[model samples]
Target: MSNVKLKNSTTELRDLDALHHLHPFTDHKSLRSGGARVIVKGDGPYVWDSEGHRILDGMAGLWTTNVGYGRSELADAARDQMLELPFYNTFFRTTHPPVVALSQKLAGITPAHINQVFYGSSGSESNDTAIRLIRHYWTLKGEPKRRIIISRKNAYHGSTIAAGSMGGMGHVHKHSYPVYEGFRHIMDPCWFDEGQDGESLEAFGLRAARALEDEILAVGPENVAAFAGEPVQGAGGVKIAPPSYWKEIQRIVDTYGILLLADEVITGFGRLGTWFASDYYGIKPNIITFAKAVTSGYLPLSGILVDDRIVAALMDHDDDFNHGYTFSGHPVACAVALKNIEIMERENLVARVADYGAPALAKLLARFEDHPLVGEVRSVGMMGAIELVADKRTRRRFDNPGRVGLICRDHFFREGFIMRAVFDTMVCAPPLIWGDGEFAEAERVIGRALDLTLADVAGEIAA
Candidate 1:
């Protein structure tokens, strides 16, 4: 590690954090006892902790830092914008150059039908906006009863009350008491865990798609406004659907005439080797929620791509939409996003992921397929997952979900790598900048972690 200096020692920092910082998605009691790892610096795909241990970032800073870290260009963009505009709101009939330029660029890259944008600071806020827009659009069309939005079980939309309600994760819902009404969930098309024995993948995919139709019928099609889903369930352990899934979903939604909302917060901006996953999957959504990679995690910015039809409805309404954020069209965030897109385009990161990064990562992940703890390994574009199981042949998960995955995750962190654990699945979404050297290092670290985790649970494995 390079010579680094800090005013306070690591222990002091941890003490201060433990005293004041309450982290998200954390067990506070456990964190207070064990303390938190202090991340001090980041460059490219590596981050250095307070103790100066350089760790490979396998999850791309929560799957947002697509262009990697420490990009002087993004810094320059933010600095330049701060020096000029600093901050401004897009509300009250006001407009700004940064947001306008970013919106135009986004329109050029998103699905052809999506020409308008609604700005927010995070995916959660934007998803909330999507729900309002969906219901409001139907209300404007004189169908006030069309309010229910169907999402898939285990899919994660966001953390806000409304967004969290849209998400189908039971754990999240347990916290959101009386989850905001108007959202229903169906089974996710996760073939590995949910597929029945003797069911072909194609058949399972169709069945999963049919789940949406069934839900719509059960809820009464007249009361359903839209269906929301991630292209490949990112937070749900990188759950990639079978080839037949999306096409069948599109047909079902079309037959019902309900809107489709593609939550591309994780899959947008070249993560899936396309500007938007909707384009890659060939699913025409009325709205596409995006964030994360747009600014490449350099700044907080997220929004939704509104189909022209929705825009037309708003235009015809001639009144307030009654929703927005203080950080909507934040000039600094928009400026950084503009520069981020420029860098991505100049480097052809999207094409690189499609042609090389995806294939390379797939090959790297496939190396773990024969490992004793691995039941399945899957990847698409820059993301991948390894299912850690007790019985590989039977695909039997460990007794307690997330227990073994946490064990393996800690091993990876201690081994100077970062991989997220979702239940018993270890998932990774590396920086788009990774190449041969990063892959080689990832292979070594991942293999070592798996071996350590296997030894920890060796007795649990079926002979």
Candidate 2:
């Protein structure tokens, strides 16, 4: 354990990455100047960077890693499947056993009326499928004009052209070409920032939900096919939805005969103390997109779990749906995901999160609830955020997003907690399997970083 040599031999990550890797969502020029945080190994919720620093994965490796890291069972499952049947395509009316078994398990666990699974490799692509399938569902129903898909401001779906446009992240879409056509946006049901002086949280939730109704009516109900949302907005600052919000959204979509597409990429696979976020929210979506935790981030795997009725419509039409990926239900990915789900069940991780999570994490957050820079501390299940605002009284954001957030995140990174600032909020979604001690340590570390960073910023402002 004495210094595992700063990086692997032959090529230091800095030197190799400089010449070879073009990192995603990063400016290559800036990356070349600053270098990378190369992760070397992981075991049970803790990872070591190339520097040999033990880093707690506060963001759960992009909000996946549900069963935690270094599970030998997942590796064994992948190895077994790779040897048995390495490759197959579901495109040519051909299917494989692992794929079949996974679909059955997914359907069985999913709430009633959702009976089919369409596979992809990530949430972005799966949501891209939802975009295609939902719009086409209208065409099959003889309402071809209904192509608009409504989303919310600050909502994050994914980075694909269609999915990123579906999101309202200014950072993602600003320099890029215009957002995808027909992906309409409305305000988020974020009560803390958007609620007025006298408005109740319930009233604000309804008001925000009503924006969808207003937009749909303005565009004409015939022109709108579906409304897409995360059950609880993740990545967009972990915004919690009020109880009235989802029910009202369901009511609105039902009233207009529009489809409800729940993007469960982060909230799926027991992240929310349930199999699907939709179940926790108490609303049924016609289509749902999932990824990240499916294989516990072991292998890239994602899928759209469709309502049986949507599948029924496609069955009645042409025999072929004319959509799929080359790696659609790829055997190895399926094997790994099946193993991940099995681990979740055998250990009862879902129920554990529901029962023990709040008390386990709340004490830590309560300590920072009164921190001056903290505008809010909100969490449900294992996912949470502590938002930093220039003025908590007004919920006013700092003039610069990346500057303040990046400064705060750098502090956390130095403290050996790998957390990120999404917009102005510091996000923390640790592996659900983390023990109480690790959980407490994570909050303590993050809290320390916040105090140091907030004071530095305040001093600068005063100067």
Output the number of the lDDT-best candidate: 1
Say which candidate scores most in TM-score: 1
lDDT per residue for candidate 1 within 41-105, as digits (tens), equals 99999999989899999999999999999999999999999999999888888999999999999
5 in model 2: Cα distance from truth in Å?
9.1
Model 2 scores what on Cα lDDT? 0.87
Per-residue lDDT value at 451 in model 2 = 85
TM-score of every model?
0.98, 0.96
Clashing pairs in 2: none
- After superposing all C-alphas onto the true structure, candidate 1 shows an RMSD in angstroms of 1.9
Off by over 4 Å in 2: 1-11, 460-463
Compute the lDDT of residue 62 as modeled in candidate 2. Answer: 91
